[model samples]
Target: MDITHRGPALPLAMMLALAACSEPLDFDLRGRMGGSVDTSQAALAAVADRPKPDDRGIISYPNYQVAVARRGDTLATLAGRVGLPAGEVARYNGIQTDDGLRAGEIIALPRRVSEPSPATGAAATGPIRPAASVDITTLASGAIDRAPATPATRTTTGTTAPAAQTGVEPVRHKVARGETAYTIARLYNVSPRSLADWNSLDKDFTLREGQFLLIPVVETAPANAVAVTTAPGTGSPTPQPPSASAPLPKDEPSPAAMAAAATEQKKEPVADIGQSQPAKSSAAMAMPVGGSIIREYSKGKNDGIDISAAAGTAVKAAAGGTVAAITENTDGVQIVVIRHPDDLLSIYTHVDGLKVKKGDAVSRGQTIGGVRAGSPSFLHFEVRKGFDSVDPMKYLQ
Candidate 1:
């Protein structure tokens, strides 16, 4: 029998053989993947470290301070700019007052020139540059590479230390034996991917004992966002930082009452309900699914409440909102995030068979998906004011 006519079968057999191979292919055959090419290293190598001098050409470190010479500056000219005597400045660095100086060259000071301050910024070159310094362990273990090196604030010793600049500074965490990156991220209420990116973990997200990792910073809503409703005579209530210790008041007003007050005023505030007080007055969020509360909110332990339900049970929206995002977790469980009025967010996780896509407008009690089938099937429901997760029970009427 002639087999030359069956040419298509040969390609199919080859594909099957490749799929059945014991070793998997390392490189991608198709070229549609993103982030596969990284230019960060090349970009970094192109830049050279330069001295960050203050207005007086002063660069201060913990143990010492130096003055940088500008272009076309001589030793005497540099000394005059920093308000120091030419003889004193030249003598300290063992150079003659008439010696030619190079721009960007450091000249040691005989005494303390100036104290580091927020205005002066951090040093350009030192053991800890305000820009590139990150918490790292010994050289034996991999060093943590915090992307987009965060700026540091000056300390009392004139050295720069991590501090809140635009957002909160990351917390330094030391890795313990037998602890994985996933567990550490969970402990701090951050995503494992974010933790990995901030610390530049290995491909397998590996961590070594005694390795220092920087926990990603989370920026929460501002204090002013808590005052959503204004009581008749009560001035703007004081905003308190959300703490796990302070439980939501059980006797707080219901969402219906708050809605009624808002109706009377003919204006409803934007939906930023960080504290229980605003949640007490805002429109209540209906339950997402009919089930028993299997787990309650426990701050860092559990950001949301878990409601037990049968697999494939219908999951509905807790409040009217625009679908903000639909994403999958590391375990492939679906997460649906909805943005409600006044900047409130309702999050439903462990969902499946989503009927609504991202950007869909959903009404209160509207069905969005079904509970994912699995052992101990349950829906995780969360209510967040800005990025801060609040108690879901407080928002559910």
Candidate 2:
């Protein structure tokens, strides 16, 4: 009877214990739910982490259009005309030898990347964009002509007048018994009037046999300036004379002093030497072993860098084009120049022997010569912008 009576009180006691534990247990349950929610949020974040696709299209770079090679063009000259380095032109076109360029042939140029389209949401990573189509139909075939001239100025009070027209500076020419003014003028691109004016001759003056006439240097006038004609009876036109008020000589020396002066005559200034032409691009047929650069381009006295190699090593053309000039300097070193269709030119100097001749068509990496024995077997390579020398490294691969 006593046990049955306690059952009702036991249930009440159990309810009191459960009520006391409910608050703490609810907090623990909430924490566990929060952790699961954080994990789910992390998984959603990972799904959204991938990079988006770029919308921009393929961009183009600046590229030169290949022009048909003309006769007598060299890589150096072509590069100069096209405003690129000869070496660079070679490298971009995969010209390992100079023989790749040939007259009437086409080649690829170093292209730049095009501007990125904003709507596409993509950007170009490399060079500037180039035109899709180049107008090679109007390719430049010759050297650029003289620039246009400027307006002439009128002399004001106290202002000095410009010099009178003169002929080109006197070049050493053997006096031929039958040579006349007209013949000489035509050969030198000088006008007959300019020659006559330079010699201070009358209109009817005749060239004397065995007499040397001083050629007056011709000054290039601005494009818009009118060419001045020579006055009749004036000896080769006189250059603008020096001002009369300039410094005077201290005194004339005696005969003995004069003799001393004669012994002490000043030496003539050295003429500017033109750069040697490179081997034709077609001559660049062979590849050098190991493909290590033997010479580097430089701006100092060397002009080009010399790559070290053994004598009798195979010498390859640096660009594609026609072999232009091949000659040995006073030092007995051989030099070659190659002209490209693009008007660029390359120069190879200090070679031992030349295998190509002037006017022979060549391609990139063609062999034009070999290193001579006993000579420092090195390639003196250069890149020319037209006739001007530039750093080859700027255009080299």
- TM-scores of all predicted structures: 0.34, 0.32
- Runs of candidate 2 with Cα error greater than 4 angstroms are 1-213, 222-300, 374-376
lDDT of 1 by residue, 270-383 (tens): 332231212223547778888998777765445678888999888877877666667774356777777676647677877899988765666666678999986788888877
Q: How many backbone clashes does candidate 2 have?
A: 96
Pairs in clash, predicted candidate 1:
270-342, 271-341, 271-342, 272-342
RMSD of each: 25.6, 39.0
**Which tens-of-lDDT digit does each residue in 145-191 have in candidate 2?**
00001123345675633322111123423337767665565455554
Model 1 has an lDDT value of: 0.58
Residue 353 deviation, candidate 1, in Å?
0.1
> Clash number for every model?
4, 96
